[model samples]
Target: MILPEIKREGERYFLSSFKLPDKLTFAGQPIPLDNWQVRERIEYEFYQFLEDQGESIILAKRTGRCFPPAEKQLADAGLPDDLKYMLLVESKCVAAAYSKAKASGPWQFIPSTGRRYRLKSDAVRDDRRNLEMSTEAAVKYLRYLKDFEQNDWFMAMASYNAGEERVRRLLKDQNITDYWKMHGPRETMRYVPRIIAAKEIYSQPEKYLGLSKKDLYMPMETETVTVNVKDSKRALASIAEEFGTYFLELKMLNPEFKKDVLPRGTYQMKVPRQTCPSRCFKQDKTP
Candidate 1:
């Protein structure tokens, strides 16, 4: 589908004075304009709800964690730097965060979508909530969307929030290619802006919002240990005592363990950087 340029009239909106194809399809599926109405309405309402909740502050806190690796991933995917802030809104930078919709990890990917991206979600190990693993998957998915949707970051992100099929249909119905000009639902309209607001706060935290410099959560540095134990809690307790640190610290460091139990097999456990020097796991007993 070809999108028309949008223009603003005196206190009103007008579609670009161009004609477009009547039908559009993405990935071989027909974009149903009628079905997109529900999605558009819901998206708009969600955007308004976030706006009323002081989205700027939430975005600021979320974007502060765009470290070099994540930044590089965004660049490699051909996505805008502002798109990184979507992670803040989606999962609050918490790798272990899960949604009521069963979306898990920093990207809040659903089980099916996670599987499509090759993110393992099994009884023994859920890579959806693993920081490094999930981030890698997210980058792959983003790159796929960008490639499929003409490299428009807005469409790519909208496709991320709403399914790619849905966004494609909206673009077809609106006869609009530019995300800012496309009229469908409220959420799509505000989705990009919320992300932009988040980027703004992240780029200049003190200027955009009143966040404490010292209170920022810095990323933790740790070493991974391969353990054969089935129960991570027991192993953590044993190791913590050996290292003279609390079990809670170990738990915090390894958020992938959903039930405080590592699945039976070889599991990757993260230990503090300082603990590596002491060889905490090799010690005999808890301190």
Candidate 2:
């Protein structure tokens, strides 16, 4: 994953030549490759992805663990598979990732939007950090955006990055259904292209970097158990002890818990498979 060297003669750095595919489709919509501006923008981001070898390799590795469940969710929801790539562009698949805009998780959901999609954020827990919960919310939100934008995936995704209200106004004011033609904030403009670029590089990592199956991270196998802490707050260390594990292991599985002591509630928690003793076992769960 060595960084591609940029050539410099005196003051200017020369970018290495990289070519785009003759035909490209994003979210089943044909990219207007004939349009020079569109081609240039996508190619710019493509080269940006290619040159940043370290980031590309990390994304390649993360795909093994992060992409499967989300892709299955998208398929089950009847959404385009490419929509999963938004997670990569949004948070680079980091579960604990947070943005300056207060967006959090792999799907980069802000607090309000997370609530709208049934992802709760309280003092004890931020469900936005849970991959399954957040992905479910993202799938629902993207479906809403797609319907709102009249089945245009790019416009739907643009709305995902920029607020839907802003994209709605841009559509009406500009009178353009085509996302390529709309002029909005710089980040919104680049957002879809960045996802497209990510999709391209991720789809064919061997073309850009050296990687193997062993280098990629596989998802951990875990079992879920329900713990009801009725009318009393409990420290995570004590809870971990109940499962014959440690505080760090419990935290790794349940990053949503904000602190060591969680408020009284029934929690469905993940722990290493077979870690719980027979005395504690009642129902079996998988993750």
Candidate 3:
């Protein structure tokens, strides 16, 4: 059988010649793999796995869309770079994303968990889904779990996903502390690998992944804008229009605001770095 030739180009390596894998079968079912479908499926899954391995790099490139501030906050909080990918895996960096179980945000904190972490969830606001607040809360909880698990990030991460109590029980029952050696649900098994994948991709973007420089969105610089606009969505739209930009740009900048409204009291707004210096105000200065 003729094998595909692997060639290196600049920082990236490609398989010049290759053979498609034999059709996979499970039970009595034969998997379908039409030409275009097979190519799309393989590319999708491959990139997904690549993003999982190198999430930091991938996420940083798409920072504007995915809450780049969270990444900076995590680093400032002294957390591992890999931990940033947890948010990516949980909510795809969308603060408003909600799960069927009521878990929400980048951290995927359930109501109980949010309460435990002192994240407020009321009519005025739901900190559980707030990117900044939830990120801080997640950092605190992860730190607590890390201490309890003896600084085992794997166990701490699993605890974050499955719950501390459950993780503790599993550890006790299995009489094991090594996450790699522990047996649990399939998700748990893939969780660490996913994180690792993201880290790898982020570290060496051009090496393992296929992304163009233009496709990568650089991190935007932003400052807090406290405007007393009851309807955040409308207010953001107004601001975007005032600035001659898109509303989605505003939404991307401020992910914590749930609903279409920014509640009463001062709300934080992030304007692009380019616009920040020109628009940001000091104590006595006006934008």
CA-only RMSD, every prediction: 10.9, 5.3, 9.8
The number of clashing residue pairs in each candidate reads: 7, 0, 15
Task: Return the TM-score for candidate 2, rounded to 2 decimals.
Answer: 0.88
User: Which residue pairs show collisions in model 1?
Assistant: 40-185, 43-187, 44-186, 44-187, 232-262, 241-286, 241-287
lDDT of 3 by residue, 65-149 (tens): 4546566776887866557767766776767889998997778999998998898787656777667788888888878987888
**Candidate 3: misplaced stretches above 4 Å?**
1-48, 51-60, 63-71, 210-215, 229-246, 262-265, 273-287
Which 10 residues in a row give candidate 1 its minimum summed lDDT?
12-21
lDDT of each: 0.62, 0.85, 0.62
TM-score of each: 0.70, 0.88, 0.67
For residues 103-170, what per-residue lDDT tens digits would candidate 2 score against the true structure? 98889999899989999998888999999999999999998998888999999999999999999899
Best by TM-score: 2
Residue 29 lDDT, candidate 3, scale 0-100: 29
In terms of lDDT, the poorest run of 10 residues in model 3 is 24-33
Residue 266, candidate 3: how far off, in angstroms? 3.7
